[model samples]
Target: MHRLAVGINYPAWAGRNYRIQTASTVVSGLGNAAAPIATAFAVLGAGWGTAEVGYVTAARTVPLVVLMLIGGAVADRWPRHVVMVSANVFNAVSQGVLAALVLMGHPPLWTLLALSAAGGAGQAFYAPAAEGVILRAVSAEHASKALSVFKMGMNGAQIAGAALGGLLAAVADPGWVLAGDAACFAVAALMRSGLTQVGGRRESGPSLVHELRVGWREFVSRRWLWAIVVQFSLMNACVLAVETVYGPVIAEDRMGGAGAWGTAMAALSVGMVASAVLMARWQPRRILLVGNGGVFLFGLPALALALGLPLIPVVVAMFLSGVGVTVFVVGWMVALRQEIPEELLSRISAYDAFGSFALLPAGTALAGPAADLLGRSGALWACALTCLGLAAAVLLVPEVRQLERKVPEARGNLPQPEPATSG
Candidate 1:
C-alpha cells in the first residue's frame, strides 16, 4: 500500500456510485445545516425552554437508536441503494410538510415533536444503508479515498448549509430553512437513484430476532470495535447532550444568539473540511488508538462554554474539535471496512449505532435536569470532564491501542468489489 497515492490525486476509477454519493451528500449536507436551525426555530417559536429543547432533540434521536438495527437489517437484505433512496424520499416529504405548516403559522408543540420523529425514522434506515453501499461502490483498496470523498462532500455541504440556515433563521423565517431542507432531501433522493444495488445476502433465518442475534455476534466479536463504541456512548451522553441541548440555550442568552452559534458550528465544519483533505492521503498505523485519542478535542468547546468564555474561544474550540471528529470517523470507517465481513457489515454497523446511540435520549433528558441541579455552567463543566475522561479511558484497552491496519487479502463469503467505474 503506497501512502503517497492517498495525497496525490483523486482516483478517477472511483466510479458512478461515488459520484452519486457525492451528489446525494450535497443535499444531505444542506439538510443537516438546516435541521439544527429548524430545531432552534421550533424552540424559539414555541417559546419553549431548556426541557423543551432536550425533548425535541430526543424525539428525533430516540427513534434512530431504537430502529437502527432493523434499518441495518433492511440494508443488508434489500438493495442498499433502494433503502437509501426510500429514506431520502421519506425525509423530503416529512420536511416539506413540516415546512408548509411552519410557514402558515406557529406550529404546535405536538407538530414539531411529530415532525422530528419523522426525520428520525428516515435516518434510521438511511445511515447504515448509506455506509454499506460503499463496500460495493468502491474497492477495498480505495476505501479511504471513497470515504474521504463522501465525508468531504458532507462537510463542504454542511458549511454552506449552516451559513445559509443561520441567515434564513435570523433574517427570514426558519420555515424557509425547513423548506430548504425538504428540497435538499428531494435532490439527495434523485442522486441516490443512480446508485447500484449492493448487499445481496439475505439473513439465513426468517425471524427478526435471529437476524439481530447474528449481527450481535459480529459486533461483540471485535473487542476493539465495541470498546470504542462504549466510549462514544458515554461521550454522547455527556458531551453531546450538553453541547446539543444546553449549549445553544446558553449561546442565546450569553452570546449573540442563532447567528453566533451558526458561525461557531461553521468553524467546526471548516476544521472537518481540512481534516478530510488530510485523511484522503494519510492512513494511520494505529487507527483505533488515533481515533480514541482524537475525542479529547470534543471537550475543548464544552469546557470553554462552561467557563463562559468569549465566542471566539468557543468557536476555535469547535474548529479544532471538528478535526478530531473527522479523524475518528475516517479511521472508524477504514477499520470497519477492512476488518468486518460484508454480509455482516450493515448489521454490525447497525448494532454499533444502537449501542453508541442508545443512551442519547437519556443524556438529553438528563442534561436539563442536571443543569437545574448543578447549574448550567456546572453541568457543562461536568459533562465536558466526564467525556474527556472516557476518551482517555478507552485507550487503556490493549486491543484498541495495538490494532494495526491489514492490507486486505482475498476473503471468502463476501463478493469481490467490481472495478471502480468512471463517473
Candidate 2:
C-alpha cells in the first residue's frame, strides 16, 4: 500500500527505470562535456592545427546528420533501450581506441577523424532511441516533472564536467581525459542495459526507407510541429553562430578574452538549471504558448553584444536566455511524449532534431564571413533580429498558439508501468 501510494503521488523519478536512465544521462553528460576539451588539446599536442580540427569536427557531424533517419528507423524496430546501450557500447569502443592512439603519441589525423566519425554515428542512433526511453519508463502524470528533473541533472552534470575536464586537461595528459570519457560511456551503457522491454518492440516492417517515408508523413502532418521546427532550424542556426563564433570574437575585441565569454556561458548553464527546477514544480495550461513565448529571450544576449553591453549585462542576458530556452526544451519534450504516437515518437523526434540541426554547420561556417562583410556589430544585430523574428513568426501558427496542455488525456493509451527487472 505504501509503495503504491508513493508511486501514485510522486513523479516518475520514483520509478527504478527512470532513476537508472537519469544516472546514465548524468554520466554521459560528464563525458560529453569533457570530450571536446580533450579532443582539441590532443589534436594540438599531436602537431595538428586548426584546419585539422575543423576536419575532425566535420567528419563527426557529417555522419551524424547523414545517418539520423536510419538511426530512427533502427531504434523503432527494436527495443529503444537496447539500441541506446548498443550505441553507447559503440561509442565507448571508438573513444577507447582514440584514447589509446593518442596516448601512443602523434596519432595520424586520419585516425582521429575516423574515430570521431564512428562516435558520431553511434550518437546518431543513440539520440533517437533515447527520446522514447524516458517516456516509456514512467506514467503520464509525472512525465513533465520527470523531464524537467532530467534536464536539471544533465545541466548540472555539464557544469561539473566542464570544470573537471578543464582541470584534468590542464594538469594531466589529455589522453587520460579521453580515457575517462570512454569509461563514462561504458558505465552509461551498463546502466541503460538494465532497462527491460516495455510495450514490446515496434513491429518490424518493410525497409528502413519505408519507415522514414512514414515518419516524414507523420512529421509534416502536424502544422504546429513542422512550423516550430522550421522556425528553430533558422533560429538555432543564427543563435548558435552568435554564441560560438561571434560572441568570442566580440569578447576579445571589447570585453575580457576567453574568461569573460566563459563566465557568460556559465551564467547560461546556471539559468538552465534554475529554470528546469521551476518547471518541475509548475504546470502551465497552454504549454506550447508559454514555452514559445520564452523564445523571445533567445535573442537578448546577441542584442546585448550588438549594443556593446558590458560583461555584467551580457551575462544577465545570457542567463535569461538560457532559462527561456530550457523552458521550451522541457515543454517541447512533454508535448512530443503526450501528442506523438508511441510507435512513431522516436522517428518523428529524429526529424525534429534533423531539422533543428541541418543548418547549424552552414551558420557556423558563415558567422566569420558574415562579420567580415557586415562588420561585427552589424552581424550581431542581424542575428539577434532574425532570431526574434523567427520566434515571433512561429507563434503566429494558430495550432501552436492554441494548443493546451493535455497530458492526461493524450497519454491515456500509454503502457502502464511494469515491475522493474533491472536497477
Candidate 3:
C-alpha cells in the first residue's frame, strides 16, 4: 500500500496479522458507522417514536455489557482472530436477517429488538478480542504507530459510510442501508479469518470466573485506569443516549432528518481521521493530561443540540468532538498496551470496556423517558453537562495528570516522521 504524504509513517513491522486486522477493522467500521443511523431511522419510518428506538438500540448494548467479561475470557483462552471472525459471522447473520425483515415489510418492533440484541452478543465477543489483535501482531515499540494507522483506516471508512448511509437512507429505504451494513460485516469476517499469529500465549484450562477475577485485580491495581474508566462510564452513557436516541429526534424535528444527521456524523469521522494522522507523528510528554483536554470537546455537539442550534453549528461541534475523542482513544490505547502485560491485556481491556459501558444500556433505555420527563432539550442538556463534569473530575487524580509516554519517539525503531519542507 502507498503511504500518504502527511508524514505519518505506517509501521514497517506491522506484517500479515496486523494488516489483516486493520483490513477487517476498516471494512467493519463502514457497517458499524451506518448501522445505528439506519436502525434509528428504520424504526421511525415504521411509525415508531423515540421510545421504540431507545428500546431496540438498548437491547443491543444490554447483551454486550452483560457478557463482556465472558467474552474477554473466551478471547484470552482462544485465538483472538478466531474469536473475532466468529463474532463477525454472527453479527453478519443477525444484521442480514434484520435487513431482510425490514425489506419484507415494516417488521414488528420485537423482531428489531431481538435481532439487535443478537448483534450485540456478537460485539460483546468481538471487541476485546479485536483490541488485542494489532497490538499482539506488532512489537511494543511500534504499537503506537500501528494503532494510529489502524484507527485512521477505521475512521476513513466511517467517513464514507456515514455520508453514504445518510444519503441512501434519505433517497432509498433505510432497509437498503441496513442490507449494506450486513454485507460489510460479512466481508469483514472473511478478511479477519486470514489473520494468524494474533493474541498472546495463555495458560490452559483456567476457569472463566478465575480469569475474570484476575482481570479485575489488574484493572483496579492502577488508580488512573479505573478512575478514567469510571469517568467514561458516565461520559459514554451520555454519548450513547444522544447518538442513538435524542440526536436523531432533534435532527428529524428541526434539521433535515437522516441526511442532516448523517452529514454531521460524517464530519465527526473526518475529524477523527485527521486527529489519528496527527497523533501518528506528534508525541506529547503528558499523555493523559493533554489527551483528557480533548474530553471537553466531546460534549460540544450534545450541548449544541440541547440548545437547538442550527445544523451547521451542530455539524461543526461534531467535528471538533470527533477530534477530541480520537486523541483520547489513541493516547489511552498506547498507555494500555505499553503498561499492561500482553498476557493480561485482553482481560484488562474487557474490564475497561465493561466499566466504561456499564451504564450505557441504562442511558439508552432511559433516554426517551428522560426526554419526556426533562423535555427533549432538557435531557440533552443533562447529558452534555454530565459528560463535561465527569471529564473534569477524572483529571483530579494525580496519576492521570502526571502520566508520561512509555516509549520516546527516538527510541522506537520506527523513525520520527519528517516534516514537509517548503521549496
Best by TM-score: 3
Instruction: Kindly report which residue pairs in candidate 2 clash with one another.
Output: none
Tens digit of per-residue lDDT, candidate 1, span 1-423: 333322323345457687778778887888777677667755776688888888878888889898999999888887888898899999999989888888887788788889988998899999888888776576676667668767888898888888777767777777888888999889888888877766565646567678778888888888898998888887877766755677678777888777777777778888888989988777777878887667888788889888889889998998898898888898889888888888878898898888888888888877788889999889888878987898888888898899887864222233334443332
Comparing 2 with 3 on TM-score, the higher-scoring candidate is 3
The TM-score of predicted model 3 comes to 0.93
Q: Ranking by lDDT, best first?
A: 3, 1, 2
Candidates 1 and 2 compared: the better one by lDDT is 1
User: Could you give candidate 2's per-residue lDDT for residues 166-280 as a string of tens digits?
Assistant: 5666567778888999999999999998887743564554788898999999999999899998999889878867765666556556775444665676677678899999988
**lDDT per residue (tens digit) for residues 1-423 in model 3:** 554455545446657787788888888899889989999999999999999989998999999999999998888888898899899999999999999998887899999999999998999999999887766776666655777888899999999999888888888988888899999999998998888756545666778899889989988999999999999998998998888898888889889899999999999999999999988878888888878988988888889998889999999999999999889998888888778888877898889999999988899999999999999989989988998898889988999999998776544465445443333
Model 2 has an lDDT value of: 0.79
lDDT of each: 0.80, 0.79, 0.87
Q: Candidate 1: how large is its RMSD? A: 6.0
Question: Which residue runs does candidate 2 get wrong by more than 4 Å?
Answer: 1-13, 37-56, 99-112, 167-176, 198-204, 243-263, 304-314, 375-377, 408-423
Which ten residues in a row are the worst by lDDT in model 2? 1-10
Ranking of all predicted structures according to TM-score, beginning with the best and ending with the worst = 3, 1, 2
